[model samples]
Target: MTSAQNIVVFEHDKHYFTEEQKRLKLDEVLENYYGDYSPFFKLIRNGVKFNQYVGVLKVGNTTIEVLPKADGNDKDTWRQLLIDMIKTVWGFEIKVSSSADLKLKSNSILDLYFELYTKELEYLLHRGLIKRYNKKEGNLYALKGALQFSKHLSQNLVHHERFYVKYSNYDVNHKIHCILYKALKLINKTNNKPDLNSRIGALLLNFPEMGDIKITESTFDNIVYDRKNHHYEKALQIARLLLLNYYPDVSQGRNNVLALMFDMNRLWEQFVYVVLKRELRVTDFKVKSQVSKEFWRSEAGTKSRMKPDIVLESRNNTIVLDTKWKNLYDNGPSSEDLRQMYAYHHYYKATKTALIYPGEEGKMIKGKYSPIEGNANASDNTCGIAFISTHTDIVIWKKNIISFIKENFFHVIEEG
Candidate 1:
């Protein structure tokens, strides 16, 4: 794929994973990713549909493959899938080139990510350079530093506050710096450094040294980015999201698979959110992705959180929809799936809720199910079903989902 060394690219269709690759085992994958006892394991164990995007899997102790799941010469199909999945899964946008020369090994997803992340990080370091006066503290009794003036006197038995003023390293700029630093370090650990590696290497001197602020989701929260200092928000978001590609506690010398892997379930949930958001009409309904906070079973100290993939809210009603990137064969929807949708429906106080799964076939399929059937008492058509094929175009897929909503869902609110 594109003459790139140490990189393998494949389509997002027709799993070509060898028998040995299929048998590849990772204890952390099942535990941290697919849940310790998740029913989704049926697919992972079978080597069927594990994740949504064309991704990487740790085949051996050191081998990693850039997987493209959508098979065929249709690079557009796979590229569109990657774009859609990335936007939804990671809250960032990537500028894509549809030209013939697929600059970062057209098929290598990881390489493309590195190229995009490095480019944006470099730009921000150059154009969005903002620094503010900051105060630093240390335990020096010398008069050389800005003296604390007897402050923290008894607390500083061995250490007094030696304050100094300089540029603040705790700003968002430093957050971007650390993300790039850690990402570069991980790339070297996983495989040979690609062409983009050198580009990132060049930008090292421009960024401030972030001492020990660990990068996590909270790093981007409540961050102020207005007209004055808003120039680098895009780069900061890209850098932060790229750093998340790795599993948090990936072992130093173990297989890099865990390090470069993303959860398919999580990816599909977000992918569906992106597609639906684009297709829906903003005037009638506002759509939100990963709607766990608006409704929950318990919100106290007990630690129980329920997050649905997409929530569509309108003046008429609020509908909660869950997306499952599973192949719903003859078995149809499972009981656990039904129970989850029921909870969303009850808590949201909405008459309409749904379970959406990839049809996994040639054509689109839709079903309206009262999953909790036979219990006539609860059989008010509270839950519906939808199936969108992986191959459908955005325009057509949106129409299908919206039509499903109109035909099956809107009636509930209208009648009430």
Candidate 2:
């Protein structure tokens, strides 16, 4: 298989291509995707502009990886940050090495997942593939196990040498192996990294060839694990991500696409929630993400709910927070965002509401919501903006965020 051409860009960055044909090829993929779902990019005059979604998109042999960039950081920094965030949010245990022998420089997010899957496979192979007793039905040269008399008689009457039997065979050729093997084929075709390809080839050689099984949502749900075979959990999780997201272009060869993208906004929200939940685990204050309350209902029972990105509740007080992935330099929060915060404060009965964003420095901007009747008195309901420096070391980033939250919303957290 031909190697893919890797291209890297930051979120909201416009990539202009010199080749007209290449741009057209990507356009075709984007057009088809937009028809069925939301388009990830907009077609410009010469190229495309990526939106807030960041991850890998492979169109034909060209792979485009969009990395999240904030506070004027380089691609590698953001790439690593994105990987860490994904690991925390998705609950994936990924091992990334910077050793001289490996020389994995500036690897894309997809490569990280690909490496994870391969590593899981290697571990399983080392432990030996698990064998499961499968009920198999086929023709055998001799009578074995239970004979399928109906099938044996219909086909074997002319050919007396053949005996059809239904037997239980204990082997690796089962659902788990089938899923892993299928994912191996997909990675071999989709991955462009030279180091990973050789590993995949070696794995396929050692792995038993199993017949293809049609995969569906229930395919994974039907799987059961015991102490003996529970190690397959990690590999199957990666397989689910790869196999379920694989899209083939039957009309054109080598034009298939695999998109492993995540919405930056939702990702930021989840990252904040996960990190806060980690930081506040020992504290009395409880951190929850997307806490919903019914807002409106129609006569037919159609209802709309309001969900705040993060909510910190203590025994006596509640603090509501919303996270924005983008920068808010000199501009203030949008009226819409402020309005949403107002609703969260009012509905949640929160003592405070704040918007958390990634920033170059720790800063706070405090504002108050107007009274319901627009009276002269100032409203007690307040919304503040807290900026956590993204340039800080990733090790201390979580603590820095938690500290900033506690300092800004000191009453609700520290005093409550």
lDDT value for candidate 1? 0.55
lDDT of each: 0.55, 0.81
Per-residue lDDT tens digits of candidate 2, residues 1-416?
A: 14446678998999887565454566666667555345577777767888999988877787889998778788888888888788778666333211123234335788888887887788789879988999988999988889899999998999899899999998888889999999998998887788888899999999898889888778899999998887788789889988887788877666787888889989989988887887665456688877899989999999999999988888888989899988776798999999899888769988898898888788888888777676644388899988887753566777777788767776556666
For candidate 1, the 10 contiguous residues with the lowest summed lDDT are: 1-10
- Expressed as tens digits, the lDDT of each residue in 1-416 for candidate 1 is 11222324442332334544434444443344445443322234443343333455432242334343433335546555665466445544434311222255444455556665666666666565665434566544444445554554644655534432222233444444555566555554443446655666566555555555676677777466776556566656655655554554355434333335455666667666765676656556678887665443455645567777788787778888887766566787889988788777677765678787765433434444454556665655466667654553644645665665566656655554
* TM-score to native of every candidate shown: 0.63, 0.87
In candidate 2, clashing pairs total 0
Clashes of 1: 10
